[model samples]
Target: MLDFTKSSAPAFQNLTPAQFAEGRQQPGAVLLDVRRPDEFAAGHLPGAFNLDVTASDFGPRVAALDKTRPTYVYCRSGARSASAAGQLATAGFAQVANLLGGVLDWPGALTTK
Candidate 1:
């Protein structure tokens, strides 16, 4: 059991691409994209919800997500979402993780459909 409370928040899980893909398919997992509006509109994983961490209401917006579920966070290049993941932890989310390199390292294609 990982003591997420005692362990450092925002610590990279550094998942393999395959593991990431699998995680995405799991039930009760949320994909959180913390990129800016423009960047998110450009490209992002299918089904990932945009929360735009830079927005003033980021904390409240993220609070709407299911805290009991695991949240997989990403940004354009892995920076912003790492911070968001930490914030999620502090806000009482138990299972949260940051995509190691964000969407920049994702090998899959993006779609707006």
Candidate 2:
């Protein structure tokens, strides 16, 4: 769970499953599944880009994305994507959001493609 009272709260948004689902439908949404490739292959959010947060090229890969766009990230759970969201915020991303509870909380939102 995210502490909305924290100073970092303004740095990015921590969205609940419902909010995540709604927000992701907006135009120019950039959803990133920050999980390992194998995990991503099993299932992931439709249209999400799989980028392992633990990989050596993670920074460079994310760097190529448009920082001004609204970026939403998640993992199996919320942990790893929280780290990735922090990195994105620090990298000057104008709009960053993390999917609270991640994909585990959205059983109906995943697709195995």
Candidate 3:
């Protein structure tokens, strides 16, 4: 479990694209794409679920996730996922990892749906 109380603010691990990819493969890990619906529809990491950080229900939506499981978050650039990761940590998520450079720097193949 992560020690979210150690600092004034919650901290989330920032993983490189390759590292993020490996983490995504872990059993029961959730790959969350905190991008807008349009952006998510264009292209996203395989198996990533769309959860727009800008949505009005962002907090509620995030709260609905399984906090015990590890969550891997990403966005167009890194900003949104960073914010989302912090939010998840604040929400008592045990494990949270943010993609360092987001999809822009992701080396893995993306899926459009």
Most accurate candidate by lDDT: 3
**Tens-digit lDDT track for model 1 on 46-103?**
9988999999999888788788887888897878887888888888887877877778
Deviating ranges (above 4 Å) for candidate 3: 1-6
Which candidate's TM-score is highest?
Answer: 3
RMSD of each: 4.4, 4.4, 4.3
lDDT of 2: 0.90
Candidate 2's TM-score: 0.89
Considering summed lDDT, which 10 consecutive residues are worst modelled in model 2? 2-11
Candidate order (lDDT)? 3, 2, 1
Scanning candidate 3 in windows of ten residues, the lowest lDDT window is: 2-11
**Decoy 1 TM-score against native:** 0.84
Best of the two (1, 3) by TM-score:
3
Each model's lDDT comes to 0.81, 0.90, 0.93
Model 3: how far residue 73 lies from native, Å: 0.1
Clashes of each: 0, 0, 0
* Residues 23-110 of candidate 2: C-alpha lDDT, one tens digit per residue: 8888998999999999999999999989999999999998999998999999988999999999999988998889999888985657
After TM-score superposition, what is the CA distance of residue 36 in candidate 1 from its true location, in Å? Answer: 0.8
Q: What is residue 11's positional error in candidate 2, in angstroms?
A: 0.9
